[model samples]
Target chain A: MTVATSDRAPAPAAPDGASRPTPRAPRRRPRRGTVARYAVLCLMVVLLAGPLLWQLSLSLKGAGDTLYERPPRLIPTDPTLTNFTDVLDRVPVLRYVGNSALVALMAVVGNIVGATLAGYALARLRFRGRGIATGVFVAALLVPIETVIVSQFLVVRSLGLTDTLLGVVLPGAVAALNVLLMRNAFAGLPDELEEAAVIDGANAWQRFLRICVPQVTGVITVVAIFAFVGAWNDFLWPLIVLSSEESYTLTVGLNRLRGTFYDDPRLIAAGTVIALIPIITFFVLLQRFFFRGLESGGIKG
Target chain B: MSSSTDLAVRERAAAPRRPRAAGARATHRWRFVPWLMLLPGLAVVITFIVLPFGNTLRLAFTDATLLRPGRWVGLENFERLLGDDRFLTALLNSSLYVVCVVPFMMLLPLVLATLVSRPGRLMGFFRTSIYMPVVMSSVVVGLIWTSMLDRRGLVNETLATFGAIAEPVPFLTDRWLLLFSAMFVTVWMGLGYYMVIYLAALANIDGTLYDAAAMDGAGVVRTFLSVTMPGVRSTMALIGVLSSVAAFRVFGEVYVLTGGTGGVGGRNLTMTMLIQREGTGLQAQTGYAGAISLVMFVVLGALLVVQLWLQQREGRTR
Candidate 1:
């Protein structure tokens, strides 16, 4: 969701030095405001979460259930996992899941290893041309994926890797944003620990691995989550790169279900639920890190 | 909102100014270790991102295809685009998308941020539930809305049941409605994401201002207009720039909603969709697609430039 125009606009950076007589008055608000706020929040929840839950309900509905009820029943008439199994029987969703997992795994590992090494290099191990390397990455941040997406496909095709999972992973393996993000993390670290290690005859690699990497695991986790979510949820690049049915990721494959089961909304709903479950589970488990990164402006969409 | 973090990273990138580097950075190290570390990262970025961008530009000028590398046909692709109705529709659709969608994005998210900014246990649940849509894939988001907006889908059925409409609206089948429906989806998925950004900016505003406003006997609306608006003025502008840029580049919503046909008569294509439609396949017109991509990139860049110009002017005024 973030573009590389990295500078956010002005924030109120005033000093909190006013010695006012009212020393932090009790935080209370009018009842009318609270009531109106809750009313709005409830509407928002219904608007945002309603569609997802509706899909879930539709997916769980039995074959005998009516989908086009005028008021649209919130609960399934006969909840069952038949739609999920039917989706599996109709489409090779497990295979697509495997494809998505492979792409995401490669992206995660590649970003963690590649970004960490380069970030440590840029931040700690000073050398010539460092500025140029950093500039190259900063420039990469400004190039929107939409612009380079087709050219990237052309590049992959030229390499004879089109329609392959590796092709899907190649363009995103070490995203420049993650590299720069990792670099920022390393640069923020205090030099006291690493300096002592350097004096004690530890090499650059050791300093990076034993000391620097562990400390920035917070950012590493952020990178990993973003990479996984991005790789899993990405629709456009994979849609372009992989043409064969066998190479389809979950996202690209789910669209195929629409053509195959256009008449059966239940089946399509089941496919979407299947596509959503893993990411939803991921958010449920790692929501702390996700929200933490979000609030601190660490993760990109 | 994450852009603020980049402000810090940019400061660090300025080099020699960061005091934390004074110690270990000087002690340095092995001769080739740094380059060796950078080799993989730099290689991947240049090969995949940077160099491909150059190729996209180069291909924009040539009559290239997937099979054979054709001769350079300078300006032919762009020139043809002047007469290309698909190109024009795409440009208009994307431009109109930015215009229609950005206002909602600017207002809804800020209101959401203000509501959820208060402290309570339920606030956490509200925030997370609202944000759930942001993490869902565009494929899923599109499917959800597509089903909901189907002729017999929930939205139409409910509208009919409530006597709001005598017939089902052609949300997916009609070109104009498809574009508008896609914009709605864009704003829906993006609402929580921007609200979180605004939450951070709202946090930065001093609590004392609200207190002072209350002490001045101002009502809720008065306090909001005077204190809250000015406090998040720059954030509103930033969201304006971000949302417009994202809206202009929109692909997934319209693509998936129309099931990749670009709606009825293929009149609903966004810029990125146009690029994809023209750029892919064995007989794909790489040149024309590249031209579309170039135009989209230039527009996005212009959006950011306008934002920066506005920020600078606001800074001057302040």
Candidate 2:
């Protein structure tokens, strides 16, 4: 189907050329426009990525090199890995990364399992209070967590879960948005397939596990990425919850690093780069799924 | 629960394809299955979200603090807000932020989406690069921009080199310019994220409509105004509300940029920061913080209703 569409795309332009007063001149006009468009786009890319790249350059430069050199270069003249080594030496970078990973992984697992179950029930089953359940889920999206953070903290404290990773994971374990996305994904599946499984003596759990869940891998992937990234990038909650430096996630840890190394831009830059690498790698490796998920879930900025 | 199950049983019985004996047994067994599936999720929501929200309301009326037991004092916390200079400043700052930032958040993305909606070899790279900031931790964004906007940072250095100014501008220190600088960062971080949304909306538009408009001798601008704008009207409304709500809830950006001081001279102080201060500062006033949150909730809820109503009216008219 795509091939046929691509084949037909050039035909209209050919006929337009035939009808135009000067085919050669008209062709050049579009080519010029295309060039101009690309030029503008390239400029935008630099503008958008420039600061990060500049940080990256600063992160690589040796301590002796002047960071504020005139006609600032994005590529360090004398690059070294000492900044990275210094960051790792000064801070418990590995421990912080591990904490981030553990928290993110727990959130991912909880979101996938919990949201999938609820989403399946909402989409495919005749549930008691289904309307109310869905309404609560939708309303949860509108209640910004920050607004209720004070009480949420008190609750966590009451539960004896504060200063723990579990406390960090539990509140955001199953986002309403992820549940809704999973519901939509489940609803998009063909009912006939599920009905056939039902008629073949499959139980509800069997049907869900074998048929429905497999079909919504795309949504699952999307949910997993969102949950992981959210848990990882989160700063305010972890900052509020975790008191000891040993329990800090990468973001909170980086914030501490900033406070301590206020005068040392190179160390801070290195810490920033270290914090960014995992997520950037995740994005680059799963670029396709990331875009698909963002498109499907309509990610909030 | 029993009544609901009875309704479900009746709903199943009314269907034509079911074999009587097997269907009856199945219905009996599965009556509670959906609820079982929903149990874990509902438990979390009730415990974490619903209860805390209720507690926030309850705490707003009392003089609750970390140590002291609370006693009910109706409207006292809220009445104090009427005269609190810091709360008023935070409210005004948030209002100015939403007003100044939401339009650019909605429109800039539209412009970027239009530019890249056309197919090109580098379109994917451009989209990803622009979106890179959105995926990064806000901590990194705050840190990078804080350094860049410093008096001796790259921004001032570049301007100085270009002879645009004689001295460095204190982007973060100055009172008025601080909010605008924060808004600039907000717009930058959001541009690609919203652009992706607009692109998704644009892709759903039928290509034949543009062809039809062109056939009617409509120019590019005319086609865009008549076809493209209306096509993504719903998305525009969605982004408008989402961005505004997000702006109203702006905390992390301000918190990180100001080193948790809410910006120099409290210029960048937002409502969330104010709430954090009152709730968890050295002299914590939990009740006042709850009142602030409830007020924010009411304000945001009203804004949402108005926007959604406007969108619905627009939809019906179209």
In model 1 chain A, where is the ten-residue run with the lowest total lDDT? A1-10
**RMSD (CA, Å), each prediction:** 7.7, 5.0
Q: In model 1, which regions exceed 4 Å deviation?
A: A1-29, A299-301, B1-29, B308-318
Candidate 1, residue B250: CA error in Å? 0.5
Model 2 segments more than 4 A misplaced: A1-29, A297-301, B1-30, B212-223, B281-283, B310-318
Sort candidate 1 into its docking category: acceptable
Error of 1 at B194 (Å): 0.5
RMSD of 1: 7.7
Candidate 1 lDDT (Cα, 0 to 1): 0.83
Clashing pairs in 1: A1-A301
TM-score of each: 0.90, 0.90
Model 1 alpha-carbon miss at residue B283, Å? 1.3
